[model samples]
Target: MPNKKLTDVEKLAIVQEIEGGHIGINAAVRKFGFSKSTLMKWRNRYRLYGMEGLAIRTCNRSYSAELKLQAVMDYFRGELSQYQIIDKYKISSRTQLADWIKKYNGHSSLRAYNGGKTAMTKGRSTTWQERLDIVLHCLANGQDYSQAADQFKVSYQQVYGWVKKYEAGGPEALRDGRGRKKAPEELTEADQQKLAMRKLEYEVERLRAENVFLKKLQEFQRGRR
Candidate 1:
């Protein structure tokens, strides 16, 4: 934290040596807070555009949305694997890909939920930005989608779908849905009538949760009992 900075020359020297197999990526990582992903990122750029690619990243060239979207599309159409896209783009990690795919999907729709002036744009619609935030939070906090969904007040399916969209198109996947409402489940009137008497579903869920809490409480109480 001593205002350390790696210059272009230093990064190039370190990255070149790693790519050339002169020094281990792990060693560099431990010595300089580098990781395989960082090595991969530098290697990808160096391989594609050489030293020029690894030059100090600037907003002008580093966060190229167009380039990221293209990579997502390429990955989606089976034209390139995520690794290949990252490798070719000199991208260091999967976050950019996830973000791009989410964004790409959002823009493909004609509806407003696609993040523009359209019929589908209304309500507190979920967004790729939100989705990515949720996904990353879940990952960083070490929870799976189902658990994360419960905490986020979204469906597990929605979370999974977003994850899929991200994989397919990057962040664009999350943005594709503007503020569109979720279609109702395909239950007919008859089915609704038949199921109306079944308090078991809700009851079961409530009871299960209560049971878990009670079990934990009992454990704690036992210590004091």
Candidate 2:
């Protein structure tokens, strides 16, 4: 929401060009280097509230739990799409609304917004088990990395890195590798069996998490269509 790149006048000019057919949306996106979604949001906001809507807020805005709940409920009523609900409630971005919907669906409590005060900006040391649990929580909650980071008191980068690493190389990849790796001959039969079982369990968990994310994405897309 804090877009220092474009001012209100500049935003209005671009929106007018797109609206007046002087430039197509795709061409505007290519020329202005803005995402299609961002451009479309500007156009919609301009239509709904004129130049006032396009003006960026100077300060951080906070929403109450009741307001968030109302907006989410309106969304579930199926009367308006995400953008419409966003425009109706003047929420900052679609991503924010999607996060709220994920929380609602996951049965997580929606507390009053405090302008992201609870988020950690710096990374912290974590063990392999803690990293794995954080990644699992993030994936299970539809990849809500911010929520996971806040809940675990770790930086967002750490949570994101762990999730990506796990997806690419499985659980063992999360290890810091500060210690020497055990040679194949150093492992006993029971040790090998335990390692294999843990790998299998992790794979199942990864697949289940992916399935949950895919289902949520599909549902959202279907609703939009």
Winning model by lDDT: 2
> TM-score: which candidate is best?
2
> What's the number of clashes in each of the models?
30, 0
Q: Which regions of candidate 1 fall more than 4 Å away from where they truly are?
A: 1-3, 62-70, 87-94, 108-225
Kindly provide the TM-score of model 1 when superposed on the true structure, using C-alpha atoms. 0.40
lDDT of 1 by residue, 1-225 (tens): 224666778878888788778878788777677667766677676777787777786553444433454465567668778878887776655676676566546653222222332211012357555786665545444435645565665644466566666566554346665674333254466645544433345356556766888999999999997
- CA RMSD per model (angstroms): 17.4, 12.6
Model 2 — which ten-residue stretch has the worst lDDT? 113-122
Q: Candidate 2 at 52: error in angstroms?
A: 3.3
The 10 consecutive residues of candidate 1 with the worst lDDT sum are 113-122
lDDT of each structure? 0.59, 0.76
lDDT of each residue in 1-225, candidate 2, tens digit only: 334589989999999999999999999988888889999888977876788878887764577655676677678768999988988888877887898778777756666767434334457899877887787667766787777877898765578778988887666667897775455556688856866666567568778877888999999999999
